[model samples]
Target: MRAAGRGGPVTRAAVLSAALAIVDRDGVEGLSMRRLAEAVGRDPMVIYRHVPNKAAVLDGVAEIVFAQLSVDVKDSDWTAQLRVIARDFRALALEHPHVVALLVTRPLATPLGQRPPAVVRPLEDILTLLTQAGFSGETALHIYRALFGFLYGHILNELQEVVERPEETDEVLRLGLHRLPVNEFPLLRELAPLLAHYDGAAELERGLDILLNGLAATL
Candidate 1:
């Protein structure tokens, strides 16, 4: 199973999917061209034929996760569409926590590699929403950046806690409430349990409402 040439013909998508599986199982550190080839049962050089190097392979993994976000933008209202997109994005990130670090660190640009077509429609949807909400192209771009940044930060923080303290729920709770002094931060202290709980979908909806509502006010 470890041998590179043990498998069959490999397509680019197959290779990327195999690489993502490796990351999902063992993390970004565990992924390599050779290992990916073995995972897909192909020649190591076969993977190189599809992606130039390990950097490209890592980028491909991110692209695969993005590809899973199959949002139907045309079928929904702008605000509802944005919330669904945000929720789906968060779900994908959480599902592939091992890729969270890389996804957060890299910008979605040509330098990282071209994103899959799956991202294009969702992105256009957000831009359309911003434009419909009275933002210029420049402002739409800023809003897109702000929304993604907030979602990514929130997901990454939650994932890091899950990874670093898998067996220590109390520790995770303590860390989450570290900023609060019990006496001075009574409300926060009282609500720490609720606050520490990370509900990606619910939070995405709430955040989207806040953003859209604020944008509506301005418009």
Candidate 2:
């Protein structure tokens, strides 16, 4: 047990900040109440004073990350606002790759009211944006769902892309696409060059263009 120091009391924000750091360096599994307390220079039991348990800590870490997400409910063009959000969300995910899992899955497990305020704030703001743009409450909810579903899928796919041999000059070798049997994956192997040099931002924009166009047709 270490002292939290004579500087100040152990605040929730400080605890969560330390937890986020541990996740950033070592992923979710690296965090524990004991480790968190140690990071903040407090006894393991003292950590319970700020957060109930590891689950709460996880929620807090996720909340801290999501608190940085900016949403403008007053943005006149809902489509353009969504575009900005999509790009910003992508950048946030990239900034904290380890926390992406939490951002995506935490809300699914927790009920809307039970989730952190910061986590739910964006949902309320987006709904407000669409409804003010003349969409019905139900329609606004659907639009929010549709947009986030696409964004979540896109971010997950982008993050999973791995270059087996990044230094390899040959595109096929760079992506390890050459290892596939020629007969079974001819097209995939042929597309090795494209796969090796993926542009996530461009892909996101193309997806948004298609999605927004199709969604607009529905209204």
Q: Pick the candidate with the highest lDDT.
A: 2
lDDT of 1 by residue, 91-135 (tens): 778788898876666435454235555545556767776676566
What C-alpha lDDT do the candidate models reach, one value each? 0.70, 0.88
Native-to-model Cα distance after best TM-score fit, residue 122 in candidate 2, in Å: 0.7
Worst 10 contiguous positions by lDDT, candidate 2: 1-10
Clash list (residue pairs), candidate 1: 7-41
TM-score of 2: 0.93
lDDT of 2 by residue, 96-155 (tens): 999999999887789889998999999999999999999999989988888999999999
TM-scores of all models?
0.76, 0.93
Model 1, position 207: C-alpha lDDT score? 73
- How many clashes in each structure? 1, 0
Name the regions of candidate 1 deviating beyond 4 angstroms. 1-7, 71-76, 108-121, 132-135, 162-191
lDDT at residue 10 of model 2 (Cα atoms): 82
